[model samples]
Target: MPKPNEPILVALVLAAGSSRRFGSDKRLFAYNGTPLLQRSLVIPIQLGLATTVVLKPTDELFLPSLLGCYLHHPLLKVVYADDALLGMGHSLSAGIRSILQSSKSVEGALVFLADMPSLEVKTVRDIIRRFDSNKIVVPTYMATNGSLKAGHPVLFSRPWLKQLQKLSGDNGAKELLKKNPENIINVALDDKGIFLDIDHPAEVPGAKT
Candidate 1:
């Protein structure tokens, strides 16, 4: 539970991608007996964060079949991004807009990618523990070769929400991060799962046909 005056943080899961690189709807692919997208949602939802999943406008045709089990989840909100094909930026913008429109108390949001199912729960908890309303919290891990690498589910504060809403194209938040380098708070994590995202069937340990 959050403290009386602690900023409210929401989880924005971006699932509106067409998965062109994966050659199909990778979100629905089975991973460890659960849909890949569902796997990605588990940790965030389990942590008790109000999560918003962004989907393509056309997902309505198969929404019932794809996410029926999660439709009634009390903490979940599903929104459609009509211009999802335009890229991840659009989906992210739609999600941030939905959060702001629905609640004024949300002072920050953790941006999650639907294809990243390998992320560890501890890593997420650590990020949440270090949340700051005035700074962006980014997770970083040391590569085997001794290089530092950044990871997913970045926490963006309220001041950056408007910029996120104005985002366009598929680049996502890369440009925003570059522009405000000083505002980022890098959290060094020991978990390598932070950098793992399944973009192909071969990437899964035992992918189904």
Candidate 2:
């Protein structure tokens, strides 16, 4: 693990996905007065992450209106991905590319999504402490009385950048995690925050802080 004082150059937030299935923009969905995306970012921002958010404006130039959605977070850098309709993988690449363009010294990239507001900060810190610049630490959540569930907020080491760039379409790291589950250390976390994501309109209300 890098020393606590060592600076981490970037954290990529993939938020450009079109919410066609959900019938509305999920990221903009509000919960407890905060946008879903805003709640999802609380953990990474505290880790000193220079977060790069990938967003695509609608064809009618909706960026101006949506800019209001991201207002007040001066640290948030919004990069418009004109081709966001392509897929989540493209958005992932776009966020990473924006970070690289800004600073090449980024030791690693912690990829989190715009819907997972439940991810615990301490769990995130635990993952960072284990990021030795070679391995990926992904969280696994076990329900107190139910089955286990796994999800994103995965930490990818620096060496995987080229392969990450090759990602296309919506298959964002799921397949890779399967191939090297051994290389991918699973940090056990009981927090449902590890498993909760606002996939539907109603699910939005139940999402954790």
lDDT (C-alpha, whole model) for all candidates: 0.89, 0.72
TM-score of each: 0.96, 0.84
Candidate 1 clashing pairs?
none
Q: Model 2: runs farther than 4 Å from truth?
A: 1-9, 59-74, 143-148, 206-209
What's the lDDT for residue 187 in model 2?
74
Please identify model 1 stretches exceeding 4 Å from their true place. Answer: 1-5
Which prediction has the highest TM-score against the true structure?
A: 1
**TM-score quality measure for candidate 2:** 0.84
Model 2 RMSD, rounded to 1 decimal: 3.4
Counted clashes in each candidate structure: 0, 1
